[model samples]
Every structure is written in C-alpha cells, then in structure tokens.
Target: MQDRIEITVTDGVADVRLVRSDKMNALDAAMFKAIEEAGEQLRNDPSVRVAVLSGEGKAFCAGLDMANFAAMAEGGKSSEHKGGAKAVPKTLAERTHGIANQPQYAGWMWRELPMPVIAAVHGVALGGGLQVCLGADIRYAAPGTRLSVMEIKWGLVPDMAGTQLMRHLLRDDVVRELSYSGRIFTAEEALTMGLVTAVVEDPYEHAMTLARQIAGRNPDAIRANKRMFNAANYLSAEDGLMMESVEQDAIIGTPNQIEAVMAELEKRPAHFKD
Candidate 1:
C-alpha cells in the first residue's frame, strides 16, 4: 500500500515493484516496511498464485540509504527499523518480528509465504538489497548487475537473513569472503555461485515468463512443491521423504488436484480454484 512499493495482481501473479527511483529503490525505514507489507499482502491473498518482485528505474535496490550511515555518524542509533516501528529491538536476541527481526522480515517474508516468489534483479543489489533478492524462491539477474554483502563496509554484518540464505546457496569460503570484503560482484559471478538462477539481458522478462507459467499450475500442487523445497534445506533425507508424502496426501484427490487430472486427461488447460 505504500507509495514506495506497488502491488498489482493479474492472472494469479502479483507483481511487487519497489518504486523509489530517486534513490535507486534503496532500503530506508519506509522501504523496509513497504517491502515487508508487500510480501504479507501476497502471502494472505489467495488470488495470488505466484509473485514476481522487481524494482523500478535504475536498480533493484542500492542497499541501505546513505542517510542511515549519516545518522550513525551523528550519534543517532542506526538500525534497519527506522519508521512506524516504535518497539524495535535493541539487539538481535529480541524477536521483533516472528523468528526474524523487522529488517530480516523485509526479505524473509518471501520465504514464509506459501507460494513461490521470483525476484527479477537488475542494476545494484547490495547489502540489504542483495539480501532482499536472496529472499525469493528464485532470482533472475540482468547481465552485469552488481551485487554485494555491503554491511561489512559499514562495520556491520548482513542482518537481513542474508547469511543463512548465502550458506545454503554459496560455498562457506565464498560467503565468508563476500561478507568479509564487501566487494561488489557481477551477476555472472552470482550465477556461478548459485546466488542467482540466471543472468540474462532482461531479467524481468525471464522472471515474468516463469512466474506466469508457475501461476498457471494448480495452486495446491505448487504450494506443496514450495513446502517440499523449503523443508529440503532443513530436514534430513528420511524426514524430507516423509514430509513429501504428508504434503502429497494433503493435496491429492482435492478439488483442484482432480481438476488438474481432468484437464490433462481432456487435453486442456486446468481451471483451478484459487
């Protein structure tokens, strides 16, 4: 609902775009709230089967706004929670938002959403920006797009769930080097590190193509797939197999599932209930 972020749903796909062109869609207090709320909207809206996240103007996001660092220099406490949130935590130990704090939720909310979220990344995705991209179920980056774990430059670590996501995607040494150096890397390098799914000329186009295809799928099956993929990272092999069966049981023979079967049998597109 925030002007900084916009959400438009069409054909069961939610297009979430960060619209702060003057700042290259940088993360500020309001931007963080907007991003978190945007994800929540997609999460709660049953009409949305998938989400495609992108940024307007020059970049996906240029990371934390410079004003934040200026505030720190001026002796004001510089943290991710800047606006609206009055009871922000003083430290990481306190849980301000579910399992993650507020800033982390800005990105982590995508993972928490039952449906798949695809990020179409271009321009700069640095520090918090990069972490936001990491939140998606998949990421597509334009060629030469720059990315970094930029918190180190400001004497901070990535507090936006980037570390946990990076551990799953990149090698430990790679994650360490990026976090330690805060060196910007290209989308090609991101793809090589598994940080990005693909590097293309136009990431938004690729992201939309995939998102629409995914949206056309049965919502129950798609949700089940997301559940399995999410559990894959944390659960053991035995538990994962059992969990898969449990999810299958919940989806199998359901109205939508049966519709999918009938559609395939009749050689037609499925008209699934959202």
Candidate 2:
C-alpha cells in the first residue's frame, strides 16, 4: 500500500522493491517509513513463505539524502522526537528494536523475520543501502554492483545495524578495512569477501528463482531452522547445540514435519502450514 515501497506477492513469494529511481533510490524520510512498513507487511503475511528485496531503476540506493547530512552537519536532529524542551533521535548504541533503532530497524527487521529474505542488489548499495542488504538472509548482486560502507566519508559511522551484521559476515580485518576506507567494491569482490551470496548477470532473476525454490519447501521447518541458526550466532557452542535440540524437539513429529516426510516419500512437494 505504500508508494515509495512496492510489494507484489504471488505463489508464496513476496517481491518487495524500492521504487524511488530518480535519485538512485536515495533514502529520504519517506523511504525510511516505506522500508519499515514493507518489512512489517512481509513479516505478517501468512502466505509469504519467502521475500525478495530489490530496487527499481538503475541503482539500489545511494545512501542518505544529501540534505539530511547537511542538516545534521548544521546541528539539526536526524529524527524528530522530544525530551522536555530538547528532541533527539535515538543513538545507535541503544537497540530501540532489539539491536537497532527505528532507522536501523528498516534493515534489521528483515533479519528477524521468520521466513527467508534475499536482497537483489544492483548499482550502488552504499552506506544504508549496504546496511539494508546486510539485513537479508542472502544477497544476490549483479557482477558490477557497487557496494560500500560509505558513512565514514560523510563524517559518520555506519549506525544502521551494519556494525552488528558485519560482525557476523566479515572478518575483523576486512570489516576494519572497509569501514575505515569507505571504498566502493564490486559485487565479485563482495562474493569473495562473503558480503554476497552469489553474483549474477541479472540479480533479480536469480533472486526470484532462489525465492521460488525456498517458497516451495516446508514453511514450518524453514522458520524453525532460521531460528536455530540465528540462535547459534549469539549463543555459546554448547548452548547453541542445546537450543537446536530444543527447537527440533518442538517441531519433530509435528503435522508439518510428517507432511514433509510424506511428500518426500510420495515424490511430490510439501504443503506446509504456516
């Protein structure tokens, strides 16, 4: 229903796209709202077993709007909130939404969703755009797609859930190098660096195909697997293994799991319930 963001769901897959192309899908205030709402929609859509995030036009996003940066430089608040007489946007350190604030939530929400979310990145996924892609479970990018952690160039750090996500995805040295330099890198290098799942000539097509494959699987098992995997990332090895056992215990012998086995035995696809 949002204008800046568009969603089209078909056959259990939701394609969520950023539609502002004129400025290469720059992040204006409206975009922030659109992204948040889009994520929320996919999260709640029971029929959506998988989601693909992509941008329309020539680029993914060019990061923050220049005017926003200029205003921040001039001592204006990035968000409009009030505390007594003074208003302040929530800082990055404060995880307003369980490891991210509202702005960062736009990216982080996708990671927390039950189903898989794939980013189909094209030209220029810089700063926040890169952060957005980091939120996805997987990233598919065009070979020449340009990506960077560009906040440093603007005298800002990457405060949009990027730091947390990168900690899991990149090596300590690689993270430090990219964050310090703010240099743009190609999608090919990103794949090698583990920033992308794969490189393709047409990233969107590849993403859709991947999404379809996931959507055809057992939804309940997929959600359980994602939860277990995410839990493993934050817990100790022993505790993570314990948690996986707990998750499996809860799902094993459930109707959907039974359906999954039956479908496999029947040489047909599963029809899992959400």
Candidate 3:
C-alpha cells in the first residue's frame, strides 16, 4: 500500500503532506495511524522548528472514508486494531491515547506538537478534515476552498476533536449553527468566521513562506510561545501572566536568544540553532 503520509524536513521546517490524494486524503484506520505517527516523528525531532501540513492532490481532505460509513450503516465492523487484529469494541469515552481516542489523536496530535503547525487547506475540508485543520496553530486556504462541520449530514457529530478546537476559534452560536446545519462554506466565509487565517490564491505556497519565516526565529522562544499560548486557554489570568514570566525567564539570555539579538544588531538573518 502507498504511504498515507509523507514528511520531509528542510531548514527546520517539516513539510507534512497527506499522500492519499486518490481518496482526497480521507481518514481511514491506516490514515489515522499514519497521521498520529507523523506527528510523533516530528515531536521527537528537535531540529524541526515548524511544520506545514497540506494534502498532495486536489483536496486537503474529504473527512471520514465512505467505506467506514457504509460499514456502519450495514452494522458491520469498520475498523481494526493495529497489526490487523480485530478491534475490540470500545466506548468513545475511553481515553486510549492520552486525552483523545485513536481518531481524535489524528488531529489533536498536531496541536500537541511542541513546534508550531500551519495547515495549508485547499479543495474540501469536511467534517473530520476540518477538525484536522483546526488542530493547526494557523490555517491558510485557497480562494475557493470548501469547508464544513459536516458530520451532522451523516447522522454524527464532530468526534475528532472538532468541538474542542472550534469552540476556541469561533463563537459559540456560530459553532452551534454550523454543527447543526453541516453546511458547506467557502474559504472567504471561513475567513470571516475566523476559521481560516487567510485565503490566498495558493495556500500551500503561502503557508510554506510563513513556515520558513517562523523557522528562522529562535527555536526555543518559538516553542515556549506555543506552550504558553496552548496553556493560556486553560489558565487563569494570574497563572497566564506567571507563565509568561516563566517562559521569558527560561529564554532570556540563552544562546539562541543572544544569537537572535546579535543577528538583529548585525542586520543579518538570524541563524537559529534547533
């Protein structure tokens, strides 16, 4: 079988692409495992300063595979455990992978990465695909890209960390309406709704440019900022302020931090050490 995901790291930026273009990169059991493994690979590589995620072909992703849904409709098993063993039926409430289940981990892992992640979305990002995009710290979409909270159409909800991610990016009512309707929205509409950072002619190219810019910053500081921002959503104002100070204290006067200052004074591009 062809690899579901492909990763290439260059100049501190890991280019992570979903390679199942034939299926619009839809999530199947193997695709889920591949995504999770890709995230973990980048997490362990200290040399990676940033990541840009995109799909290989026409679409970013088309959400869950239709076969899985068909199986569900037929009341037949739709997935299996690793190593091809039959999967033991389990409740969604089960936390199989930290705070998420197998499916949720596919997207949530991107958010959990220490380095920044930027999603380059094009074509369609439906249901679970949108959830995967939401996991990124930032998202860029092509001008006519289509998106939706599409699970409702399949008599389901966004179970792949979409609720947790959408609540933070969009207003409560907006998220509720989208979830209830499962309506497809354009990239322009998504930008207005705060679902996308920008809608450009070429999202992947723009995302790579931004990724390279971010990769040039002091790696320690960048990672620290990601950590602080991730915690900000859950922390009180007092704790948030304290975290700022803590992260600053750890980064201040460090080798990479000093290099950043020196490069600025020298008027040369910063040469950051991963």
Better of 2 and 3 by TM-score: 3
Instruction: Supply candidate 2's per-residue lDDT for 228.
Output: 83
What overall lDDT goes with each candidate model?
Answer: 0.88, 0.84, 0.90
lDDT of 1 by residue, 1-274 (tens): 4678999999998889999989999878888778777877787899999989999999999988887778767666655554575222346667777899888887788888999999999999999999998989999999999999999899899999998888989999999999999999999998889999999899998999999999888999999898899889999999999998899899988999999999999999989998
Instruction: TM-score for candidate 2, please give it.
Output: 0.92
Q: Please, what are the lDDT tens digits per residue for candidate 2 over residues 1-274? A: 2657899999999998898888888877778777767877888889999999999999988887776776677687655422111122534465556756777887788889989898999988999889988999999999799999999998888877899899999998999999999999999999999999999999899999999999888888788888887777789989988888888898889998899899999999888887
Candidate 1 runs further than 4 Å off = 78-83, 86-89
Residue-wise lDDT of candidate 3 within 1-274, one digit each (tens)? 2379999999999999999999999987778878878877998999999999999899999998887787778675656734352232346788878999878887798899999999999999999999998999999999999999999998988999999998899999999999999999999999999999999999899999999999999999999999999999899999999999999999999999999999999999998777
Clashing pairs in 1: none
Model 3 residue runs over 4 Å out of place are 79-89
Number of backbone clashes in candidate 3? 0
Q: Clash totals for all models, in order?
A: 0, 0, 0
Instruction: Please report, as a residue range, the 10-residue window in candidate 3 with the lowest summed lDDT.
Output: 81-90
